[model samples]
Target chain A: MGDFDFSIIAANWRFLAEGLRYTVQVTLTAMVGGILLGTLLALMRLASLWPLRWLAAAYINFFRSVPLVQVILAVYLILPLLLQFLTGRLIPIGADNSAYFTFTIFEAAYYAEIIRSGIQSIPRGQVAAGYALGFTYSQTMRLVVLPQAFRNMLPVLLTQTIVLFQDVSLVYAIGATDFFGAADKITQRDLRPVEMYTTVAVVYFVLCFALSRLVKYLQSRIAIIR
Target chain B: MNYHWDWLFFFQEADDGLMYYQWVLSGLGWTVAVSLTSLAIALLLGSAFGVLRTTPNRWLIAIGDTYVDVFRNIPLIVQLFLWFFVLPELVPRDIGLWMKQDLPYFVTAVIGLGLFTGARIAEQVKAGINSLSRGQRFAGLALGFTEWQTYRYVRLPMAYRIVLPALTSEAMNVYKNSAVTYSVGILELYFQYKQIIEKTSQVLEITIVITLAYFVVAFATNRLFAWIEQRSRVPGMIAGGQGGK
Candidate 1:
């Protein structure tokens, strides 16, 4: 107990902060990109066309079924190779960038499900009213449905984003310098596993716990009137 | 495509005289062991804590809530890392060295995985119990059954039945999260992924094979849980007594 020295964390705060910045950056990128692609996937899955529905279902199922760590590694290794095979050139998407792509696509599967549920939660009459107004299908979704769905599902979406934030740590498998990975590196270099990992755990707990509390509050406040 | 595809690489010998497929199988065994053992821990702990949260006692509820918050909010990998590396340092010198040098990595991974998943299962259990109508609790109390007995008989069984579907998903997640144990260098399937890839330099094939392996396990878990859910279902209960799907 006496050996507890947080000076290690204090000395390396900047390095740790850089890692924290990368983690947040990836979370935001994946959040925006995943939600975009996820909305597309959700629409496809909800479409009348069987082929589009099937394709979206397959993508969601395949990604959701695998571990995030494996996909991080797979994308880190396989994505570039597949690209080179098709394009005849090796595009250098580094491990860090690879984490971005993997999380975006992988998380899109989950976000798609959330979005699909959100869309489902909106009554059929709302869509019908849009159609009754002589609005086109795309127009109804873009103008009437999506905005409402986004608001109604905001709490759930934020909860998932909190999950995504924690998941950013899985990039450690592919050697990305995320917050957890930064702590890991410092631990290795300084041989102070106690201080480094403890600090990381405390930071993660405070952030996630506070965020989840916010989600709980929002769920009560912004819940749609049924 | 400049890649060489060797479908027969699994049959090749490694340095330890085991075929490459044997190594993969060994890793798979560890993965299964880690997940199944952790599931046992999770179910027991989750049920206990789950009941704790729903109990009338404020003290018990506090303990359960604290457990859920601490374990669930922290990423599993961090928990695993702490349990694996920093735990020993925090303990007394002799025992710490023993833990560092003597404790099996498999046990460490399972403890971390179990506690983390247990917190999640507790939440599910709490929800399941909460979803039940208030009349049932009142009826149990009117029957002169003590609070513990009432829970032991009436609430828990129905709660388990009600939340079997959610439990199934958590069970499947145990398999997925087991991959994180690889970071601690346990000889699990993910660890072997690095091994086979490094040894044979066959990235694409091995990656596909491992991914398929994970998918199969997860899919099977889903099906098994579906079967269980249907079998133990009570008529006119949640989901209108329909299939869990």
Candidate 2:
């Protein structure tokens, strides 16, 4: 309805910068943590032991089935109590810390599935060859299978990271001042809801769009010829 | 550490004569309705744009790409806020006023969610179509079918079957993403959880119940799609294997 103004955002650049920093921090942290935990889950899901497989399956299924907002809320509330019980000391954890923990655990479920499929996509002969080479089971997975699987799944992993970036905004529900939350605060303070929201939306779009392009480039580069 | 769990709190009557479970159930209803309605919009528009992207026309592809890039990149929460607060002001004055004052929150949530998810679905639909061999499209054309008719009779049917697994995941994603509507003041399941937590101070219990409710919905959706995928499988056509968030 009116000409857009970027001055409001420029004036609050520091707040926006801090929010952006937090967003990037949480996203990268969750990506690493999620992938690490997810790889373990993926390994467990594929384990020879039925119990380990079932446990891994159950964890993935439960987390994947529930909405992530609930997970964030649950973690935000339950984690402190959990830590208190474990350590016999009350630890006051902030929403930001809980958001970090929640996203790591929650995203691990998704990454587990992707990694499982990635591992599965490797030819069975590769595992056989590793065994023929007298490699231990763990070494076969670590040194032989995993290297190929990572290449196969790199694009999907990066795509999921883009999604993780978008989901970082949900931390706002827990009162963590991530990018979206900071924008909302500016909206409240400046009485410029439209400009604040639009600016944040554009920022998110640019970040995600760039990441998606990266995913595309990786996909083309690593595409295996059948 | 001394917090007591009150599982029976859900049965307690509120000031409005409805029990907490009733509130939760109503919220679940809205969640289901909003997700389904928006999913319908997403699939319809997504398929149209997807088809346009696959067409020979450059302009159509550009339009499709623009829609996907713009909608797919922005966070759903931001989009919902835009729909709820900003979209009205951008429209014509009278219509904008009507939208601001008279349009229901539910409708606004659907528009926001539908368009956001639609962008994602458009990409999936485009991928589905492209996965097919070019020979299939040429076959349809050689059989004297018009381009649209060729797509209708040959390409789309095969593409839909091929992409059933991906589509299943997208369907579940839409349902999960609907939770973002809580930001726009829609009393979906997540919002109900917030209300219960605020009223009873039973954050843990309420979180567990809502989490279970969401799980049930998502699990049921997954099963439904899996069933469809099984029934619709074409013998020679390779299934697009499961897994996408």
Among all candidates shown, the one with the greatest TM-score: 1
Q: Model 2's lDDT to the true fold?
A: 0.88
* lDDT of candidate 1 over A155-217, digit per residue (tens): 999999999999999998888899999999998898999899999999999999999999999
Clashing pairs in 2: none
Error of 2 at B49 (Å): 0.8
Task: Report the C-alpha lDDT of model 2 over B58-148, residue by residue, as the tens digit.
Answer: 9999999999999978878888888887877677889989998898988888988989888888888899899888998999999999999
Error in Å for residue B73 of model 1: 1.1
**Superposing every Cα of model 1 onto the true structure, what RMSD results?**
1.3
- Report model 2's TM-score to 2 decimal places: 0.95
lDDT of 1 by residue, B84-120 (tens): 8889998888999998888888888899999999999
Model 2 C-alpha lDDT per residue in residues A156-221, reported as the tens digit of each score: 999899989998999878989999999899888888877888889888988899989989988988
Residue B70 of model 1 has an lDDT of 96
The CAPRI category of model 1 is high
CA displacement after TM-score superposition, residue B135 of candidate 1 (Å) = 1.7
What is each predicted model's overall lDDT from 0 to 1?
A: 0.91, 0.88
Instruction: For model 1, name the residue pairs that clash.
Output: none
